[model samples]
Target: MKLLLTAISGLLMGLTTAPFSASYLAWIALIPLWLFTISHKTTSLTPGVKNKLKIRNIIVNEKTLIAFIWGFAYHGFSLFWITGIHPMTWMGVPWLFSLLIAIFCWLFITIWGAILVTLWSVIFRLFIGSKEIGNSPLPPLTKGGEEQGMGIKKKTWLNNNLFQSISRVVFGVAVWCLLELLWNQGDLWWTSLSYTQSPNNLTILQLTKLSGYSTVTAAIVAINGIFAESIFVLGVNKKQFSLLILTGTLGIILLHLGGFYLYKQPLINDLSKEINVGIIQGNIPNTIKLYASGWRKAIEGYTNGYEKLSNQKVDLIITPETALPFDVEYIIKNSSFYSAILKQKVPVILGAFGSEKRSYTNSLFMMTETGNILSRFDKVKLVPLGEYIPFEDILGKIINRLSPLDSRLIAGTSDQIFETPFGQAITGICYESAFSEHFRRQANAGGQFILTASNNAHYSEIMPAQHHAQDVIRAIETDRWMARATNTGYSAIVNPKGDTLWISEMNTYQLHQGTIYPRNSQTLYVKWGDWLTIILTILSGILWIIDN
Candidate 1:
């Protein structure tokens, strides 16, 4: 029954994410599971029954199975759309076999996320379920058949219950954020609570300007922990519960109010250049994007698209990742393609695959009006299994049993900044926008703008919108205006504050021309990446240590 409730809570949490976007539910979604973690009420041992009463507290440091089950439901609901990348899509395999492989990949992601959640649960359980914590000033909790109110004569101990509850909440937020940072080390760091709260809630989103998303995530999780503790003590604390209720209730209100104040502060200055940019949403379908027969039509589409955009006389024109589907050198050697870029005498930034002696890189570069390659920024962060699969020697055999090609691509060096006609711009290819630090590094290095090229053709409808929202978070964190060029529509221009200045419709080919304002002042997050979040996380750990 407990496991069932935990799974339900997980689904409720997933619903607050994309495709549903009922983000208001995130505040209350985790309360059920959190309460389950701390529930250890002792039933009355009246004369009616003695040994039949079963306690409900979770064991110390081994909260794996329930945590895994809960996380499985949560991540499975949120990431089910990833099945679109099954071997059948690009491999042309059997339908039934492809469906099974997709399901297997989806299940692998669910299990991987479940393990991280389980680690958090185990560490939190270890702290709150220890015997050394009894000497603390907090009230003596019931333990080993000890009465709750028997040894709580001291006033210092009376407040232990309050401190313990808050400490439990702190422990949860700290450990959860710890794992969040860990996964961000480049393996399945997709759905942090901070990323989930984008464009929908600007007040919470403002927190990103001062401190990166990790701080906002910690604040939200801590609030969930408080709510869980309050709900668990609902009927039992009727006598002296007013103070506890006030503290918990006021804590939530104050947190949001503080966030709102920060959001409304005069944070960004409008001192930078106003860029007149045009982006092409090529709307290329993945079915034949790489096919030999479709090469003529693909080249014609981009050439004609550039002609239409050149008429607008925009300062910079952008194209999605791999807009040039063929080999870049071969395509550039053709005078017909170079004529389209050279005719307008304007700079164009487009995505293409480049090769350097047997090694290929997913790269973005500046194409000058004279048909010269100005500067190139190869993709620093590569997607796993999608762009380049890991352990290809072992997993490649199983993957290529159905698919055709399974090879590794080369990774670019750390220092990359593309100097374009419109100032120095930091370029992020595909999922690289999801990592906030990628932008921060370039922003600190004097890159004034962000240009991200993504191929959203591979995923479902929900994916483009989700990807757009993540980019909005990046603009807020770095205080830099950003432009997104996607292959399959939903190209957009976003301001420093994450407002969508101009957005193209999905699944439709169009050129978006708009005026976007950049920022000269660096945000606190851009100046010092994740420093505030790291400090608070360490403070939470110290609180956990003091209580234990």
Candidate 2:
């Protein structure tokens, strides 16, 4: 029964983002998990000072396993879109064989992601989730409340519970933040829960301005913690119901106030220079995009999109990842599109393959209006397996031979920034936009605006929206206007305030023109990065230890 509740909570939490995008569901997503723990059997409260909590440490192993179950269900559902890769079978392998490989890949990632949830749950249960906080009267632990509790006014646990509850919530958020930061350094950063809030609850997404995603995540965990604590006391004191409502309202208000205040700061008229960009969505079919025979059609798709956008007087034209099908240089030197783009006298930003020292790099290039190379940004964050296989030196020999996957591209450094005529333009090829730290480095080094190019043709109907949702967080973190160009939809322009100024549709060819202003000032997150969030989490952990 507990397992089912946890799984359901995980599923509901996923619905708050991506294809469904039911943001309100996040508010009550974790209630089931909390209810299970709070309503379970436990030890009686002891009134004496210095008395131990008598917490059987109940549900020790069960909670951790339940957490795994919840995480498995959550990630499995959230990432099932990856099975879209199974179409590789059409590349040459047997259909059943490709489907099995895709299934293996999906399960592998789901299990690995579940570990982050497991770690968080275990630490919460082991450290902050102590039954004392689950059911402790604060008087004995409350400073100077020791005398009053002896007179039987001992229900003051609410006050005491507040401290523990807040600490646990902070701790819970820290665990998530820590895992996300770790993933940012790896290949899985795209799965962070911070992206789950979209369209609606961004009203409170303001905490992101002060402390990056940590504030938003902590606030979310805090809500669940408060709900659980309130449930524990609902029968003990009907008054907790009112207090919980008040506390929840105030917390939500503080978040909104902070977010709205900072969100407005970027709106003031300033001296920042602006550059107009024409974002093109070609909506190319995924079937033949990467093969040799279909390359021309893909290139022509962009050529047609350029013709539509060129006359708008846009300063530059941007295309989705690898929209050129191969490198643009080949087409420019050998094709008519070069003269067509030159006729417009505007630079072009598009994804193409670049070769370096006999190795290929998934790269984004800026071509000058006169058809000269402006700047090149080799994709620093490469997708594992999709671009290059990990442990290629050792396992590549074995896996490459057996699989139809291509494993040759190299990774660029985090310091790679493209110098545009206006200012530094940070380019996040595909999903690299999901990593806040990688994007911030370029912004800190004078990246005025962000350009994220993605190709979502490998997934089903839902992926493009989910991918775009992730970009919104990057804009909020750095206070930089973001330009998202994608293949197969949702190419958009997002302001530093986290507003989607405009977005295109799925499988539709469209052209969007927006102006981006370069930002000179930096948000607290862009300046110090995740260091402050990490420090606060450590401090919160220490406080939990001291309070316990």
Q: What is the C-alpha RMSD of each candidate to the true structure, in Å?
A: 5.6, 4.7
Candidate 2: residue 46 lDDT (0-100): 50
Across 188-208, the per-residue lDDT of candidate 2 in tens digits comes to 655666677754455666557
The number of the candidate with the highest TM-score is 1
Model 1 lDDT tens row, 219-324:
7787777767766555545422465566657866786787688666664445456778889888877777777644665687788878887888887788898887
Per-residue lDDT value at 108 in model 2 = 76
Question: In model 2, which residue pairs have backbone atoms overlapping below 3 Å?
Answer: 138-157, 206-259
Question: For model 1, where is the 10-residue window of minimal lDDT?
Answer: 53-62
> Least lDDT summed over 10 consecutive residues: which range in candidate 2?
49-58
Instruction: Let me know the TM-score candidate 1 reaches against the reference structure.
Output: 0.89
lDDT of 1: 0.73
